[model samples]
Target chain A: MNEMIRSLENKPGLSTVGGIDCDLHPASPATKTLLPYLEEYWRETFVMRGVDRLSLAMTSSPSRAPINVRSDWKAESGFAGDTLEAVRTQALDPFGTRLAICNVLHGSMIMHSDDMAAALCGAVNEWLAREWLDREPRLRGSIIVSAQNSDLAVAEIEKRAADHRFVQVLILAQNDEPLGRRRYWPIYEAAARNKLPLCIHAGGSNRHAPTATGWPSYFVESYVAQASIFESQLLSLVAEGVFHKVPDLKVVFAESGFTWLPSFFWRADKTWRGVRAETPWLTEQPSDIVKRHVRFTLHPVDAPDQDALARTLEHIDCDDILLFSTDYPHAQFDGLNALPAAFGETLAKKILIDNPLATYPRIAADFQKEVAK
Target chain B: MNQAVLEKEKNAEAKLGIVDCDIHPAFGTPNELAKFLPQRWRDHLADYGQRSANPLVGTLPYPRMTPGNGMRRDAWPPNGGPPASDLAYLQEQLLDPLGIEYGILQPLAAGSSTLNQDLGAAMCAAVNDWQLDKWTGPEPRLKASISVAQEDAAAAIAEIEARIGDRSFVQIAIPPRTIEPAGRRRYWPIYEAAEHYDMPIGMHSAAFGWHTNSGAGWLNFYIEEHYAFSHSLQSVVTSMVFEGVFERFPKLKLIVVEGGFAWAAPLMWRLDKQWERMRSEVPHVKRPPSEYIRENVWFTTQPIEEPENNRHLLDTLRWVGADRLMFSTDYPHWDFDDPRYAFKVPLSPTERQQIFRENAKQVYRLP
Candidate 1:
């Protein structure tokens, strides 16, 4: 069995046979590449409005930077993961990703006009569905939406919900406002209604400075600071009473380093004990709410050493809180060993498949259907 | 269960007092600073109040955790004034009852970090005097921080120089949120002054309208704002380290108050990790980031991070170095820590004495 598995792994194609890949990036080739996916009216509108050659890449994660993409992962002339075959060979097949959730992070969230943003989101989703998921059985997609307008975001979610392959909805970690605000509640309502987890990936719309004081001087500061941004978003959701409003909502912080969770949970819970009156909707401790509703992707796995990693996992404690991911072609880690060896087998299986299945009911249901067939 | 253990527990409450490092003393009113200001600034105050970068007038842009605008509900003075105003009331409630030996006062008022430099400096001077007369004068256990409008570097230096030798003042308190990262070369003059005076810079978490509490933008809830305090401290620590503030002033020390210390160890590890990869971008950072943090920075414990298991907290404290941990109450604030119950771990008596009193005494050179 081991010899057969090893031989099959060497084949040049995507596979979700044994494990679930929670995070993978499938780039929208470019604005020009996505033009065919858009309705003709919007396509002409884009050309007439002179919105040609849109860079869709986040400023924080500049596509051209050496740090953004690994040297080995890049294709001959363009960026890695720009094509379906490259994603298959580099991410899915190599990592033995039984199922991979594609988070198409093209800078649609930054669009100033709600209509344009909504239209671009529609285009991105259609592109993912037709170009990636339709062609690849192992691939699943995130429903891209313009969080700037809840009505539009809801509409987008409803439009994409018909496809069971799209298991989650995607939003940038940095947004115009907190994800818990009522303005964004409709999006959550739609996501919850469709059993889709609201996945907050590491990229941002660059709508604001990445830190509290102001724009950081270096890229590393901005990069390291996203975890805090995710923390604020989590606190916002808890404090502004979002979980109470949308009880079934599941959150995935993809590319957010997981080591900060224990301390953050501690601080949040501690503060809630004193200030619970302000946020009356919080019925349980912040950590309790988080453990039940939130799942973190393990990409950065940012701990100083093996002992530190062990300590972080011990603090996290719960088996269901982490999901495995390569964060493919994004230069987070080196080689095929995306899951750190220190994680061990039991936790590895949970992160790779079980936790993800539990988090996304629709995906689990689909997996059941596939097995029966 | 033993008689000696019971006696030690009882004795721990009575005389083993905490040297509370973060006691906020607010003004009874903005008008309290009138005596310290000149006519032009006074007229400006009447017409414009504080022309701060934030929209609100002499208040935080967002409300905080509790009823008395982030103050402990019980901390409100019996005489119908703002909390932290009446010294007699503070002593009666916080100092006397908590068995506070030497509580360092962090006067958070309308001064320092305000836009109008002259008014800010004058109000800071006034706040310092008020700290001396109103809070510390009758209460010998209370110590003062020389408040200054940090933007006006020369004026800030002058203020420090004025109070350089005064034993009544122990440190220079600067707000965590500033126009730039507090370690920018523009702010180095203040560090120079602090080092020359042998005073540690107290960077307390406070709202400055110059920017949102979190860089991603304004947070919705006070809980989020509260969490952002540690995040702000993280930025300040990074700013200090990457900007070579330590290399510049080898003797200078920093005490980050109210922003819990559990994040300190991890942040240092992260900073060091990133510095290794991006060292060329910031060549001035002489040593690994953790080295600068361990040697130069001290963290106050308040709103302490409480993991479900006490062992995790102990491990974190071990990583942060027991000597670097100073016990702070954040007295009169909503989230004040009771030193007796704050630390969940079983600290050795020597560890307790160091964290509670000796560490602070050593840092501030207290007699």
Candidate 2:
């Protein structure tokens, strides 16, 4: 067992200094913690209804799952990433991350009531800004939005567009409907208008089972099945003409493993050739559109070994599509060996720093201002 | 020559033909299948009609892209029947030309995973009987799959028992998109029956299911829905591995047909990694998930993944052992692969033999 682990571990030469971590999960705030951030009317209603006592963490990442918390990183109480101080010392400091994007996975985003979902999502964004972004100089945030109502989702994106710290708009891969439906176009339009990339992370609303064939008995199945969810959503986005409509929209798939991309691209491109007339809006191949408009975060590198990872990267063929991420506090890897050993220094620099800056315009603008100063 | 050299030469000579594992054989006419069903079912088929979970009745909700109901352009027969409906046409178009010594029939009639359990089971039995009487009995090179509605364990087992000792039937055919993940205890009886009979279970990707094709939601275009086949199969593999189906039925063999094999290696890696962290949740999964998959699962190659770089395909094949892949053309389908041109990479003679003929022959115990 020890030998197997050692063989799978990334080679230790890559440096993390000044790298931009694309995906870091800050713990979902308990309802009690978000009371101050919520509007007065909603806050009062929450208190009156006793909703404040509930733990609003999404079920996608169960609190007890060993993969949710590394043994060394757990705090004295609650989840390891619950506090900004813990994140600063444990996630941001260890890797010397110049900028780490925080994607908060709260249950509020998946609520049944559209208005309530909107209200709670707003509060979570406010909480993220005040509690984490205001204190940490090196941290950035993703604006959490509920897609149950597109108007409400667009409003949230517009509200957070002014804040440079929120580099992208975050939505779940599995939602009430496929994210590429025309109903959700308003959200993408708003994202493009603001130059904020859409970040579809690995989690679901629990509206449906994580697998197409209904629910599995264990979290292990659900977690491993996330890659397929990502695949479906990507195909939806491309086939439903979301890219053609929102041409400027740069989509980032965070916490979605990239090893599946090569075969998926092949299948997508091959099928598109035979069925091109079905989606005439797509003038080019699906893989071409994906390569042009989409970027993937690196974590939970699902390859078996260095050689396999290298082959995957080679098959993917585009250097600009992968952005660096620690997937902080999620136990995707141990210590600072987040970047696989297959990457040489040049490719490592591109993935860790260059690709992220190019993907998120807001982050790049902030970097430009800092450079000018 | 020495004895070892003589044996090697003989083995090489014996490995000349191919075992095509995923040949879809359609009924010659709707009434042909109805003839095999009971009179009650035949009346129900005519009166209430054959219903599935999809909204559209008597047609697919998302129409297939290719003409002739998603068949290859040239596959439609001159006798005015749908592609693969006439065995003579199929033999002429695929088997004779591809040099297929043995062809396994996987009928995609949506009989195994439909919402109507009774109708599903009836349709499955009818398809099984039709395969034997119409195709396999007349053609010795062709073999039948014992079709069953997997949601009804008793019905599925009974169907298997009926065909237990028949050499005409090579394996049990189930749908990847079932009422539940293929691994749950609900489906264990069928697995036990397969094990007892020493028959492999073939999970061919089906088009109809109660749930949407994707985890996200119902898809919009045929392309997206077609791509969902791989995702559906991936979930089945994950479920079966983590749910300890293999641990409980160690000798049960699974041949995942039509879904490409490139994704298997990475999925196994991910499963093994997660099992190491979450083994307590599934204590019955005694060994690494990859070990069970490598031992119990076999994958068919059709709609084979065509990576831009041929070396990458070689890497995937190396990771997933060459011996684990069986050559399949998904015959008569729009995305059929010719055995001669499917693989872009140069394979050694041994690897080629294992993939094209030896592996399927061993798994199916074919003559």
Best by DockQ: 2
Expressed as tens digits, the lDDT of each residue in B1-367 for candidate 2 is 1222212324554458899999999766668788888998888878887788778777777887776568888888899788898888888988887789999999888888666789989999889889989899988899999999999999999999998878999999998988888898999999999998899999998788868788888888888888888888888888998888998899999999888998898788788778888888999988888898889999999889876566678888988999899999998888998887788777777888899999999999997
Q: Per-residue CA lDDT of candidate 1, range B216-275, in tens?
A: 578777788888988888888888888889999989999999899888766766676567
TM-score of 2: 0.97
lDDT tens digits by residue: candidate 2, A237-276: 9888998888899999988888888888777887788789
Quality class of the docking in candidate 2, CAPRI style: medium
- Per-residue lDDT, model 1, residue A133, is 88
Residue A348: error of model 2 in Å?
1.1
Recovered share of real interface contacts in candidate 1: 0.48
Cα lDDT, model 2, residue B182: 88
